[model samples]
Target: MEFNFGWEMLLLFFAAAALAGFIDSIAGGGGLIGIPVLLLSGLPPINALATNKVQGMAGSFTASMTMIKKGVVDFNKIWFAAFMSFIGATLGTICVHYIDVSVLDILVPIVLIMIGLYFLLVPNIGDVEKKPRMQEKLFNTTVVPGIGFYDGIFGPGTGSFFSLSNIALRGQQIITATGNAKVFNFASNIAAVVVFVVSGKVVWLVGGVMIIGQILGAYLGSLMVIKNGSKLIRPLVVVMCFLMVARYLYGKF
Candidate 1:
């Protein structure tokens, strides 16, 4: 369900997508930027959201690949977790309506606020590795699929959730943690895109335009993260989490 907007409009949205990708590469919540622009471009809400995922997948892929090339992340290590995340998201999509999201809708923002606070309060939290609170196998089996399921069901803050899980449970530094988060985030996005595409809700024309910008921005943002580490990541993650909290809360009140 693609719409025929002018190149001028497409360019405007492309810039927004680029900004989204830049922020998303550091933290998560690119949708906080991309989705609004898509909506403003006159697409229906569902179409805008689906298209945002389309472009977002591009950003995630770009950032993930850049990290892999830079030796910051080893895809081989997290392959199984990525697979589990993908499968969980697919299942979550299939079971979307069967699950009651009312509780989740309320519970999620509160959790996001707490996460935001954690980042703000503990400045040195993710700068270096800490003792793992969860086992690797256990984290892979549980948190990976858990966040992926949440991604499919509610569709926001998946990256921050993944990054936090990696840092807190896997004892990863924030930069590497963010890179690992992108992989699973990409996997979950694939599941989302598949479901959205099958439902014919995506506006590919808009998505295609935004994707170019996403790629460029994600690449640059990933480079900065590589150079600067948590100094760049912490503030952005903080901003994105609170922004995500605001977005979710706005839906309620």
Candidate 2:
């Protein structure tokens, strides 16, 4: 399909990317906004998904770096998780090139909805740090890699999953978990973007335009996370997760 790179279209998409980056920087599920905006702009589904990765990588990188500079994330502790996430995402992206994603269409939304409900119903779930129930190594190997693989293959609610895992299993404070989530999200996004770039699926013009907005939005959102802490992030995470569920279920039925 052919697309017109008009100023009007660019502005619309840039606005959408900015909003997506803001929400994604805090709690994930940015694709719920970005991909739909791309589709509405007349791109084919595959192209929309591929192009979304470019802007997503920009947003995640911006947020991750912002958190790092703010001293919210400790790279020494998270480097292993980040590396595992990158590897998992790479493998998942390769699998996507060969396999149908329809199966995940049903499964992923269910999981996201469940996660949303968990956060919504549980009181003070991530407000403060608690004693970890699982070993850090186990978390890096299992939860981190598994979520990274899911992010690469499915590409939504990854931030929520990462934050929830850190809070529930690793006993991290909500703000700290959100910071760490960005790191993993950035890793997975880079892996997916590389695959999309190699496959010639990215629309560089559109992606490049949206990336400017993504960077700005991500920086602002990261600041919000630092300022508002869990009070802001928790509700956003729950909302984003449910929004992802609705988006996917609508696509399915």
Candidate 3:
């Protein structure tokens, strides 16, 4: 594939990146918008995914920083999870380079739809403050690591999956859950970006522009979530889930 980014394409992608960054930081549907725009921009699938991760790193970093500053995360406890997520992401990237993403494309949407359906069916799910079902160490070590691996592998609905799992299985408050999710998502993206850069898959100029848009949008999304509450997050998650379903279905046909 010829690697050239026209100004018009750059501008259009920047807009999409901003929207994806904002929506993804808040509700985890950024890839739904970002990846499609990238594919439409005339890049191959792998290149698009690689470049998207580069931009996503920026958004995740900004959101993670904001959430940390706001005291929405437990840094000490989450550091281990972050490390594991990075490792998992690196492994995922290598696997993607070698394997086919089509199978994952089919599986991911099923998982996302199930998660979204659960959220939709349960009344006041995020509102309830409940104790964790699993022990903290076990959940962090086993549950979080497993999710991190999936995130590294597939790269969609990661934030929502992390948040929902934290809330449902770990029984964390919504704010803290989102904050920690950002931290891990940052790690996952960093790992993917490292792989992409090493493999020469990313278009730095294009990725850089997308990163700028992602940063601004992520900042705004963090602000909005802090101002609003789980009430806002729930609906957005549903929408993102629907979008994921659509993306997967389109890919199949």
Candidate 4:
């Protein structure tokens, strides 16, 4: 595929990336904004998804770094989980061609809706830490990689899944969950990036500009999460979840 994007289109991508990064850093579903813009810009589906992953990784990396600097993410505890996520993502990417993903097409939106509802209706969820429903070791071993695998296969609400599971099962505060989600999401993204790069689907020029935008947007969003915690993240999570659902429905139907 050949892309000769002019300044106007370049600026448009940068704007979309910045906005997506900001929202993604806070609540996930940045792809809902980013992917459509990529497609609209005339890249084929594979190139768009591939290029979007590049920018997405940059946003996740920036968000993770910001949170890590603020000491919200515990590197020691999440290191193993990140490794598991990487492994899961690699397998999922390789298996994507072989697997039947139609079930996921139906199930994921329902799961995202439930996650959104859980955050919406639950009082004081992720406000203060409670006794964890799942042990940290078990959660890292199972749920972390499970969500990573899902992301590699069909990514849309991966961030929400990470944040929600961290909060609901692991009993972390929203700020903490969001921070950890970035690390896990970044780990999962690495495997996908390698695949895309090998297949020559990525557009480096578009990805380069978008990376700059994502870094800026993710940094600002991370600051907001650090300052406001659940007050900011909760509402965005709900909104992003619904947006992800709509994206999935539109694609499928």
Scored by lDDT, the top model is: 4
Please write out the lDDT profile of model 2 over residues 1-253, one tens digit for every residue: 4567889999988999999899999888888889989998888888998999899899999999999999999988899999999988988877877888888877888889889998889999878889998999999998888888887787777888899899989999999999999999899788888878988888888999899989999999999999999889888888988888887778768
How many residue pairs in model 3 have overlapping backbones? 0
lDDT of 1 by residue, 1-253 (tens): 4368887998998899899999999999999899888887788898988889889999999999999999999999999999989988988887897977778877888888888888889869778888898888998898999899888888788899999889888889899999999999999889999878899888877888899999999999999999999888988888889989888788779
Give the per-residue Cα lDDT of candidate 3 at 87: 78
Best by TM-score: 4
Greater-TM-score candidate between 1 and 4: 4
**Model 3 residue 248 distance off true place after TM-score fit, in angstroms:** 0.5
- Those runs of model 1 whose alpha carbons end farther than 4 Å from true positions after fitting are none
lDDT of 1 at 164: 87
Q: Point out the higher-scoring one by TM-score: 1 or 3.
A: 1
Tens digit per residue, CA lDDT, model 4, 1-253: 5799999999999999999999999999999889999999889999999999999999999999999999999888799999999888888888898989989877998999999999999999999887899998999989999999998898889999999999989999889999999999999999999989899999999999999999999999999999999998999899989988987888767
TM-score of each: 0.97, 0.95, 0.92, 0.98
TM accuracy, model 4: 0.98
lDDT of 4 at 99: 83
Question: How well does candidate 1 match the true structure, expressed as C-alpha RMSD?
Answer: 1.2
State the TM-score for model 3.
0.92
